[model samples]
Target: MLRVHSENELQLNADVLVIGGGPAAAWAAWAAASQGVKVIVVDKGFLGTSGAAAASGNGIMAPTPENWDKVLSERYCLGKNLANLRWLERVIEKTWLSLPLVEDWGYRFPKENGESVRQSYYGLEYMRVLRKTLLRLGVQILDQSPALELLLADDGSVAGARGVQRQKHCTYTVRASAVVMANGGCAFLSKALGCNTNTGDGLLMAVEAGGELSSMEASNHYAISTAFNATVTRGVPFGWASYTDEAGNDLGGYINGRRDPSFLPNALLKGSVYARLDRATPEVKAVIERSHFIAFLPYKKAGIDPYTERVPVTLVLEGTVRGTGGIRIVNDSCATKVPGLYAAGDAASREFLSGLASGGGGPNAAWAISTGQWAGVGAAAFAKSLGASAHERVVYPVGQAGLRSQSNTVETFDSEEIVRGVQAQMFPLEKNYWRCEQGLLDSLASLETLWQQVQANPKQDTVSDVEFSRRAAALTAVARWAYFSALHRTETRSEHIRVDYPETDPNQRYYQATGGLDKLWVRRDWIKDAMSGDKPQNVKVVTGAIDISGKDVGAQGIAPLPRLSGHAQLISGDV
Candidate 1:
């Protein structure tokens, strides 16, 4: 039954509720709804137009027919230190299956004279196809409704979520047997260069619900960043770029004849990085335009060829996409430790491609399609397994008291001021590309203070003010998590370079970090071949808990997580 409390408030029922309307949520909804499950998807923006998938610079990473062996080796075994090996294998396999479906739905990959061109980043086309597929399959999408918290039953199993409808200024409850936390990553604090809503909402929900986050310390993503734009990071892979200082000296070294993500940091040492493609062959330049020419499109609009001049770029702290550390899912199932809960896309710790490397041209695109479909099917199966519980229903009590507010007048201060303070504190060397013991400690102390200041105030005087408060709170949690995770890792690994440690300790791989704001720590049971005797008894490492305080959603009388063996419970079969 479609139960409406009023036009202002809504009480809906769904068998599977997929939060966030990105590729992950869309695929999950399609799978669940296609299987005759009632699925509802909620997002902070419009369905097809919202999220990073709608942005340019995303591709499917897979082995070309001729280079399958070499590409597979590079993606999984020999080239990168992958945590989920089987998961990566499945991703590659699923790429072949998913690509044809996307093509059928009208996603045009670049083609030249009847031959399909590779390295095309599907942005707008990808999201449109996904949204159309969901609508055709009867999946209900609720845009402009950002999920605020996860709703739990008597037991800890996920029972849907509570979110605010943007225009309505009202709260709604979605009752479902299973929930998919595909709300995406936490890069919004990078001034919307990433998705504007990528502020760790799903991460916050997972932690309060007792789920663990994995490999979070790997920070720093090289992008076409500057004073004005953040969207150009996606366009860098297919452009002719340069790095020069105030003196106009070339600083970027050839890592396969162009700038690579890893090399961007060093490129910044002497000067700023710039995208210069006006000098390249027309084919390459054409591909750049087709991909997301906005990097230099401004120059073109100004009647100046980009190659004639240089546009500056820099690096930023990021999660997912270019780095790791997200909700840990087992194998290729996308199922977490909590029953009826699954994570996909950037929200999950893919750990497929190793540290600091982004296999976006092909790998990341394949991951979004593959894992999303699997998670959808997995969530549907979970809903089916609930038996009578699957059909169980209750009109959850919704009220102003049940929800958290942004400002409390007395507790709240200026949101913009705090945001600027945070970004400034993070953009510097000590906590970013150049991390050290003292610098990390300094970063942690300052963030902790900011977190306390924010927590002391939770009031919403206006809609924008509330939005600002929510964004600030979410960013603070994400930043604190990243800093602590980086501090715990004692070795210089990939993008997570600890200058003081400076060496990639082989023994460090035996254990990986996983924790929440309540207690920051690491566990080793999941690490491959990490036996108890793997390390000598003489070594000492800090494993105690540190409180990264944010607003306590736990005040809602949330249930503690139950013990369940991951992978063992996975009812796996390709979707």
Candidate 2:
């Protein structure tokens, strides 16, 4: 079924299609190919050099049977009873097994006492080995191809996807029996090193196809980084580093010899903040230099020693890239509510493991490896079940609002402005990190206005235009979902801190479910019922409709949102 329709279009067919160019996408393709099915991977960048995993070192949460009980207990407790123990147990086991496989495939783990260390990995080298192994498996890889939207079969299952080939200046369409979405998460264009391209593209495409998002309120994650630098946000070195305010006053943030995660952001709310690693021992300094040599390069160029000099520090908004929010997976197979479609890694919510808290670093890396394998296996099995009639189904493209305008007439709008507007709402620490009822409402109203602008614009004329517009729409949609979910939770829990509702409410023990484009809805779903595959009752919050001209259509007073029996939707007057 592979065809060259013209010089501008390339059509392809595969048993399984994996979207993304990260560690999760690589593992998914590997797993699918292991099932003896034809698999294709499409990435926005090169396979081995894209995504957050490729630009950072990560320590994996791999536990053996001996320590599994202790590790699982601690991690589950960290989630404050929202993390699912079953999923945590599965992640530990899968991660343990998967790491050794990587070593067997020629990745050399750090050794100690004549035994290979399996605790961590260097992102760049790890991905290179993985890319090599995948090529050996006969998996076809498509680089620099970013999928704009998903296609659906006549029966409403995901059929395949279509995207622009940036390097080729054309378009490519793939028809497949099953698809895996592992394209990572949105960072609101924060430029956090490797996360520039992680703009919730998969999340938006999935939602447009009737998929739902869970725990999006947990998407607010900020990492402490040196001023004017996006790389090297590693917190270990900061453990011994001391923080000071503009007047050189101590912040009293040293807790158990490590700085609290909230210390920097809280200090930043007032004025400038700076850090000094003067307390780091020689051993710590050596580790920092060896592990983060790239980060120190700029410092060396500027003739500044971070160990001795005062370095200004700022928190970078990581958004969903480090947060535990994304497309809701319905089962252990990482399958979404839409059949034949699966999601993994940052593209799928990790709430089953991290709940309302952030699951960046170790927990996220483990979840990526485990869920990627599960999704791939599930997709392959589904594809195999289709037998020879897989390609016979009638399919339609489901992309809208990005590839084409939601409105009939093509309208002129600045996509970059839309992206910047989203950043203004999401990237600020005071607006997103600290939550107040009025602040949430204001941010939501602004996001709604931006969303309307996106909906009115038409498809672009070039590949870059299409990608830019799509990223803008995707980021705006993600911010809206996060704010809506945050608005509904009401209670302060884990990473979701509501200043108005400062205390944790025992009654709010459910997850918030959000979906819909024109009619954005947020509903509370009982965790137990959701886990058991039963439909849970919905508790809603009213966010009155806002018009496209940035006017409040039916703005309600600053009163407590009543717990409505039915769903509460945030609609736009333009829509």
Best by TM-score: 2
Expressed as tens digits, the lDDT of each residue in 1-575 for candidate 1 is 01112355777889999998777788778878878888999998887877767755565675566765566666654313433355556677776666767777777777889966554446677788889878888888898888877777666788888766767766678988888888888774675444666777777677667677766776454455543454545545324555566667766566776545446666566455665544567787766566565555555555655666666555555555556667766534688767788988778765654533554445666777787888889999989888655547442421111125324545455667777767766666545777886776677667766666665454464444555665676666667677766766678766678889998775664324355553344443223322123332443532321111111112111122222233211111111
lDDT of 2 by residue, 1-575 (tens): 01212375989999999999998999999999999999999999999999888886887888667999898888877776667878889999999989989998999999899988787789999999999999999999999999989999988999999988888888899999999999999988887888988999999999988788888999998887788575656666776777788888888776796657677778888899888888889998898777666667657777888878888888888898888889988777888878899999999988878878888888899999999999999999999998878888999998777666677655756888998899999988889999987788788889888988887764466788888888888998999999878887778888888889998875565556677786666655544423333222353533332221212244332223443322233522111
In model 2, what is the error at residue 14, expressed in angstroms? 0.5
Model 2 whole-model lDDT (C-alpha atoms): 0.82
Q: Give the TM-score of candidate 2.
A: 0.91
Off by over 4 Å in 1: 1-7, 64-66, 77-79, 110-121, 192-194, 226-230, 235-239, 252-263, 266-279, 359-361, 388-410, 461-466, 529-575
lDDT (Cα) of model 1: 0.63
Q: Residue-pair clashes per candidate, as listed?
A: 10, 0
The 10 consecutive residues of candidate 2 with the worst lDDT sum are 543-552
As a whole number from 0 to 100, the lDDT of residue 343 in candidate 1 is: 88
lDDT of each structure? 0.63, 0.82
lDDT of 1 at 44: 82
TM-score of 1: 0.83
lDDT score for residue 561 of model 1: 21
